[model samples]
Target: MTPLLVGVLGVFGLFALMIFRTPVAFAMMIVGYFGLWILEGSRAASAVVLTESYSAVSNYSLIVVPMFILLGNISSAAGFSRGLYDAAFAWVGRFRGGLASASVLGCAVFSAVSGSSVATAVTIGKVALPEMKRLGYGDSLSTGAIAAGGTLGFLIPPSTGFVLYAILTEESVGRLFMAGILPGLLLMTLFISTIVLISYIDPKAGPRGDYVPLSQRFKVLGRAAPLLAIIALSIGGIYAGVFTPVEASAIGAGLVVLLAFGTRAINFAGFRGAVLETLKTSAMLYMVVIGANILNPFLAVTHIPETLGNALVGWGLGAYGTLLVIILAYVVLGMFLDGLSMLVVTIPIVFPVIQQLGFDPIWFGVVAVIVIEMGMITPPVGLNVFVVKGVAQDVPMATVFKGVLPFLLAMIVGLLLIIIFPPIATFIPDTMFG
Candidate 1:
């Protein structure tokens, strides 16, 4: 068969494996290895697998993955997420929809330390959902806010999504982290605004929270100070040029561990559990990286990206039009695939087209993550929605999906603003590094 035909078949086979409950990393690896064997000789394919596996594991930059995961796991085990929620509630829980807004703010703050969207959703949901329910908040607003806010984990600094994007595209990790800051904050604001608009339309959906005294607000802020300091030191150090992305991860993880021990928040068993979880998460990410590396060469051999890029350019759509098509594809695919799976499978094919269109890679990284965030709350396979559903067990699945709709619309608006003003994602990186 022709190389293009082989590439097409390989894509189909990969999806089939996913459907059969094969892990994404292994599925990509199996398809990629066989595809390479067919295109080249057995010897070349064997060498590719061996070398790619070694390089993926040995690459020093990949250390960021496990370290950041450790930081998040440790923080979660130490109950820092509760502190973040309390602080946000103290500050924003007095207005209409204030509890919902506090949930969004808490998720955004916790996301700075915990880079996983599912974890952020689960952690914040367990804390905020109960409070909202007890305070007479509607399920739609409460669950919707938590699910939508959880996506911030991927867009904010220290994001695992950004790290994976950087690894796949060979972009600067530090620059990508910096690029996400403004956009992350923008999305958070949009989420909060969505809650406000919803509550305005139906005040009973989200009643005003009891007023918190200044003394209590400051006290809660003090409780959350350690987490705030860790975020500042790690992400702030990157912006100030005091640490590389890898170094920042190390510092962040180390500090969180120390804080956990000093505060007696985590015992030895809890610490060990955190380490084990980090290892498992990191190993899974490494396998996906290896699979992507092996598949990249096969895709290149078929000239599929070039062919597609040329075809799109030949169709006479302007850059923005082509981009719209790509974004729409992501929204559709997101209904079937999780964010990381979508990223690993599609970037090898779509990134070439993006580069050909003269778009900034850093900006695209932020934009692509925002699109993935939408998938996390979208129907059929919305990961964050389900996570929130698990927390709010009495709330129907449809209700959670309905709750996330406004936030999804808010995300789309935030995405459009970024697309229209690319500098919103690029200015910090340019000013800091240029």
Candidate 2:
């Protein structure tokens, strides 16, 4: 009967729906609508739903979602992913464990294209896994690298995770995008270093790649240039204040579409398929936003976030100790829930605790995103690991999980560095926007 009780029921019910195979978006929408009805009657609930849905859909900044999704989809359809992978291979494929390293690099580059971790994993895995196998690379190392690398999609600029975090917390999407850059590169470096260490311990696990001539490398790099340039122009333009995030997204998508057709890399049929895929993905994201918006209001009325924040701050745990608790909780939730689901479900409660602790919001965003990406390759529900498994069909799921263990460790180290330095996530944003 009490609002707080309804809010508690709504949280459990949301998880129950998700556990029962209900879509996260619809589940949130459902729980929030009915809970509001219970707390304050149907008119408020209906109005909340109507207004939030319209607001979510009509928000101009949100245009970035479909545009970026289209940019990624079109790039995938046009075979630009292959071009990027090939360029990476040419550059990094000569050293020990280089093929696996190349996969990481390829994922990092392609992360700038696709904001979704699954899309990044699948696209690069399709290209990198086969070549690694043919070159006699070990399954665990190859699959693990691709899976780990794919998580860059969640941490890098143009990331869906950032966009959703922005919408939820009302942070600047552009600053969050900027915040992600160095941390993403830091994680990429650590992943490559992990491959190096693995190779040093077991050379046969990651055999050295054959030589690639300088001329060949440059030639392949040239082939990969258009998409890279588009990525640069779009992301760079945002930082340089040359364009807004919405404009940058539209420009990126338009340029990729032009490149696809101009190079004859994608036909009308392929273009149509890309558009349809974009529509589906964008719609799902939009619905999630709407649902989160609707649910946030109900949660606010119950004062659950405020209560949690107070409880957390009341504890003797210092800022770092409280942070440790939150991170550990995320790891547990991540084992059962997908990254986006974990994100939306927790941020309302978590964000307040974070802000009350006097931690930097932008910095925490990177930390939160990196931790979620860790979940993408973690055990049980490891989303990116399964994506790599799906692509590298012969590799066992356990092998994929085992392979990611080292990279996951690398991610932790990278995360720790960010937590300690803080500048790793905030420096660029402060320098750019200040």
Per-candidate local distance difference test: 0.93, 0.92
* Model 1: worst 10 consecutive residues (lDDT sum): 294-303
Write down the TM-score for model 1. Answer: 0.99
Model 1 Cα displacement at 15 (Å)? 1.4
Clashing pairs in 1: none
- Backbone N/Cα/C clashes per model: 0, 0
TM-score of each: 0.99, 0.99
Candidate 2 lDDT at 124 equals: 93
How far in Å is the alpha carbon of 281 misplaced in model 1? 1.1
**For candidate 1, lDDT tens digit of each residue in 173-244?**
999999999999999999999999999999999999999999999999999998899999999999999999
